[model samples]
Target: MAVIITNRSLADGIYMMEVAWEGVVSPGQFFMVRAWETDPLLSRPISVHDYQDGVVTFLYQVVGKGTAILSGMEPKNTIQLEGPYGNGFPAVDTPLVAVGGGIGIAPLYYACRKFKEDNPKKKLRVYLGFSNEAYRVEAFDAIADEVVVDVGGIIVGQVDVKRGETFITCGPRVMMDALCQVVPEKNPVYVSLEARMACGMGACLGCSIKTAEGNKKVCKDGPVFPREVLEG
Candidate 1:
């Protein structure tokens, strides 16, 4: 169990919650979070927005009953956090480009920060898309060589896919598909997918997805996957 350090609003229906966590969390991993013990039967999988010191942050939108409950909770409330699960974005030595849309931007912040820390000399660019209001777009300025924001339009068009550049993206399926269509098959493109999960663990087989390699569970095998695997 983790204690909520802060629960505040970022924009309408969007929230940033900080929890006291001492465990190691990778940039693209997530936690199955639940604030109530009994009311909601399942925990919501929330991507790690950022982690610093002893706090793990979650940037989420109140999209359903579970998230609505989470948004209503106050500081000091105890919540269950089941993991730092699944494969995270791999460390890359090449110039990196990260693209996110709406709430999918949650995981890219930490991923970009870590990449910059490890590869200070390499170029890092970020593009964020929002249907309406934009938040935290300025935060990328510190870590990215370039940052671009698009409101109410496709953000992927701004990306200049260069050879030898590694691209990682999480967004609406349509946006990701469009990006993939433009990227050469030889370039490495990683995608983070979203699905409803009954159990964060693989035992339940609740979040299985069809891939090139038969079937894989999102909670166990990935929430992040190579673009090629998805294509096949």
Candidate 2:
């Protein structure tokens, strides 16, 4: 069990929850968090916003009953946590272009931190899009070499997509689909997907999505997948 350190609202319904954790967790990995006991039987998968100093942070939007409960949780309250599950973004030596929409920016923030730690000289460009005002802009700006924000327009169109560039992104399906269409065929792109999940483990066939390869489990196979296989 992880103890909640802080749970504060960052935006309208979006909350940032910091918990005391001990283990190494990668950027795109997530934890199945539950603040209630039996009321909302299953836990919610929340992406790692940042992890440092034995504290792991998660950015969540309070859209449902489970999240609403999480939002109301106070400091020192212990919550059930399952894992730092799912495959994270690959460590790339090539320049990285991270594009995120709304809450999708959660994972990218940590990914950028890892990239900068691995290769400080390499370029790390971050592009974040929001339907209205942006949250955590200062946070992204701290780790990224360059930061771009789009409030009302298509942020995908602003991406230059240099040849052989690597992109790591996550967002609403429509936004991801649009960005995938814009990315060059030769360029490599990785995306973190979201789905309704009953169990964080693979036992339940809950988080499955059809891809060109076959039906893939988001909870096991990946919350992160290559763009080619997903788009194909």
Candidate 3:
């Protein structure tokens, strides 16, 4: 169990929660979070928004019963967390381009930070899209060479895919599909997918997604995958 350091609204329905944790967490990985014991039954899988010092942050949208419960909790409240699970985005030498839509921006923040840390000389560009109000768009300024934000329109259209660039994206399925269509054959694009999960481990088989290599569990094999494998 982790204690809530802070849980506050960033915007309407969007909340950022910081929990006390000292675990090793990778970008694109998530934790199965639950603030209640008996009522909700299962935990919600929330992606790592950022991790620093001894605290891990989660940027989550209050969409349903579970998240609503989470949003109501105050500081010092104890919540259950089960993981830093699944395969994370890969570190690459190529110029990095990150695309996020709405709540999808959660994981990419950490991924971009880690990328810049490892490849200091390489360039990183970020694009964020929101249907309404945008939050934390300013935070990317520190990690990105350039940051572009779009509202109420196609955010993917803003990205200029180039040769030898590595792209990482998470968002609405339609937006992700649009991105896949434009990326050149040589440039590699990786996507993070969301799915409802039960155990958060491979044992439940609740988050299986069909891929080129049969079905893969999102909670186990990935919440991240190369565009090619998903396309296959």
Candidate 4:
């Protein structure tokens, strides 16, 4: 269906939005967004970072040919959106702690919002680690009670807290590795990995990550997996 481009912004080089589309979108799902008339490379997948009524917001990085084409679009323009795809982060209880590195912050954005909506009394803390201090997103303070690091070098810093809070992660390998080491055990932490997806559906097998259960497609089984399922 056509999602009206109500608003758009350049998040460094990435594009963020406030789009109004018909229908209900799941809290942690994504839609394949692109100007249909100007189809460049099939479809570019972007996740629904947050939503309120018909207005669904996606925070996407305008990287590569597909995303670059999306960034140039204008308001009132019709963009094709296919989903609410893959498995989103599991909803949680207890205090919420979310961490993302670089553009991986996209899913974490929605996850945190969902957490707060479900549990109003719980405290929310976010740590957005970027490739460098320059690439670090500047808006963490708005959503999180605490914004941890905004620097270069190591994207994942040590996380210290009780063993019962919920955690979510999305970013690079080294960064996730660092986080996996630190997050408390059995705390309901989920990780979103950046892998190639030829088809958002499971047929193509482009984005697969091994889990404790079996070989799972990131496009199918995840983008978000329980921390215990990850190999570390």
Candidate 5:
């Protein structure tokens, strides 16, 4: 369902938090948002970074047309959102390691906030990697234990992957794959995928990901999924 909320900008192009919603919004759930009515495209899917009180927050880079519009809104301004969709990151009672890169950092932020609430006793570690220190998400510092950013901090190439017993992520395929390789096949590992999506639902059948269980939708079935499921 669509909920109207007042939005605020924390930074000119990076941070923005929203407050105003009537119901529960869980970790890893996304909001379908449309900031400009004149624009031809429909609402864009943005993952919830964290929500407290009646406020919901999102941290995104100005990477596209839709997000650029969203990044421009002022405080007390209202925006439309349809939301809290898709399966969330599975609850892990044990220690969890969250890894992220670039725009993919939002999902892990949501997870860390939830962990602090639900599993206060468990050790929750968070790691973030960006192309360089400049592009890194500093917001992760509050949520993560040991944050890393460097060309060679965790894994290399176009991906940011790290494996600890209990781990989850949202980033490029190459980064997720590197983390998957280190985490034992038997151990539980969750990865939030960023696959191309024409429609953020299963109807388009556009975000199918090759899996052991067969192709899966990155939007409907995921955006969050088990790492083992991706291993061939």
Candidate 6:
């Protein structure tokens, strides 16, 4: 269990939650969270938005009962948090391009920081998509070389896919599919998937999906997978 340091609404139904946890975490990893004991039955999975000096933040949308309860939680409230689970985005020396849609921006923020920290001279580009109003864009200014936000239109379209580039994205499956349509096969692309998880672990088989490789568990084997693995 971790203690909530702050919980505030960021946008209409969106929230940013901060908790005191000192464990090592990687970009694109997630945690199973819950403030209640049994009413919701299963914990909700939230991605790591940002982490620094023993504090971790999560950005989420209150789309249902579990998240609503989480959003209502006050500072100092203790919550159950299960992990920094799943494989994280890869660290590469090549120029990094991160594309995120809506709440999917949560993990990419961490990825951007990781990239900048590893290679200070490297160029980093971030593309964010929101249905209308935008959020957390200013946060990118500190770490990214370039940041572009698309409101009301697809952010994927703004991406200039080129040969030998490396791209990473997370968002709705439809948006991800659209991105795959235009991206060149020669580019190394990674994607984080969203799924409803019952156990938050691989044992339940609830988040299983077929890939070109075979069926894999999103809670354990991924949430992050190479685009080639899914396509090939």
TM-score of each candidate structure, all chains considered together: 0.97, 0.98, 0.98, 0.88, 0.83, 0.97
Model 5 over residues 84-147: C-alpha lDDT tens digits? 7778888778777777766677777878878867887776666666654434356566655556
Q: Cα lDDT of model 1 overall?
A: 0.91
Candidate with more favorable, higher lDDT: 1 or 3: 3
Error of 1 at 161 (Å): 1.1
> Over the stretch 204-228, how does candidate 2's per-residue lDDT look in tens digits?
9899899989999997888899987
Candidate order by decreasing TM-score: 3, 2, 1, 6, 4, 5
* Candidate with better lDDT, 3 vs 6: 3
Give the TM-score comparing model 3 with the true structure, all chains together. Answer: 0.98
Off by over 4 Å in 6: none
Tens digits of per-residue lDDT for model 6 on 135-173?
Answer: 999999878988999999988889987566688999988
Candidate 4 — which pairs collide?
A: none
RMSD of 1: 1.0
Model 3 RMSD in angstroms: 0.9
Clashing pairs in 2: none
Candidate 1 structure quality by residue, lDDT tens digits, 144-218 = 999999999889888888899999999898999889998898789999988889788888998999998889998
- Global local distance difference test of model 3: 0.93
Kindly indicate the candidate among 3 and 4 with the higher TM-score.
Answer: 3
Model 2 misplaced stretches (Cα beyond 4 Å): none
The parts of candidate 5 lying over 4 Å away from their true place are 1-13, 134-139, 143-145, 151-164, 196-199
Model 1: residues >4 Å from true position, as ranges? Answer: none
Off by over 4 Å in 4: 36-39, 132-139
Better of 1 and 5 by TM-score: 1
